[model samples]
Target: MRILLSVLALMFTLGLTACDMNEGPAEEAGENIDNAMTDAGNAVEDLCEDAKEGMNAEDEDC
Candidate 1:
């Protein structure tokens, strides 16, 4: 009898907790996309700066 009551109590508690869980993955995906876009933009900006520096150095050497 005690074991049955314990099992039922555990099940009820877990049910209530699980019911509140957010199962949608869209928010996580959106955050990932935003981070990726920021990284890409930063990388492009860095590349442009490096290229500009190289061009200026070449100009100085010539």
Candidate 2:
């Protein structure tokens, strides 16, 4: 049991150290964020189209 605990602790420490490593440069991060925003906008546009279709169908039924 003690050995298992020590191994777990060592693994946790190593994982923490890995996370501490420097991330990608700011420029790349900005570009990735911009791409994510564009994707989100496209998704929202598709949802709006779906809502419009539903509203039109409802109008036809009434």
Candidate 3:
């Protein structure tokens, strides 16, 4: 009985590990989203700076 119980417990632990293995793809997708957002934010900031520079004289506040 004890050996059977131990075998069942081991199988259950392995099953959970198999489910956890799928998290790698999710983590990778999350990282990709994060990088895209950062790039977009940077582009917006650069455009804002360019607009400000275009509207301002050499010594005036924009």
Q: Which stretches of candidate 3 lie over 4 Å from their true place?
A: 1-23, 57-62
* After superposition, candidate 2 runs with Cα above 4 Å error: 1-24, 57-62
Worst 10 residues of 2 by lDDT: 53-62
Runs in model 1 deviating more than 4 A are 1-23, 57-62
Query: How do all the candidates rank in terms of TM-score, highest first?
Result: 3, 1, 2
Cα lDDT tens digits for candidate 3, 1-62? 99999999999999988886555777999989999999999888777778778888473332
Q: Give a tens-digit lDDT track for model 1, residues 1-62.
A: 99999999999999999887574798789989999999999888788778878777553221
Estimated TM-score per prediction?
A: 0.53, 0.50, 0.55
lDDT of 1 at 10: 99
Q: Residue-pair clashes per candidate, as listed?
A: 0, 0, 0
Candidate 2: pairs in clash: none
**Which candidate, 2 or 3, would have the higher TM-score against the true structure?**
3
Question: Over the full model, what C-alpha lDDT does candidate 2 score relative to the true structure?
Answer: 0.82
| Cα lDDT listed for each candidate | 0.82, 0.82, 0.83
TM-score, model 3 to reference: 0.55
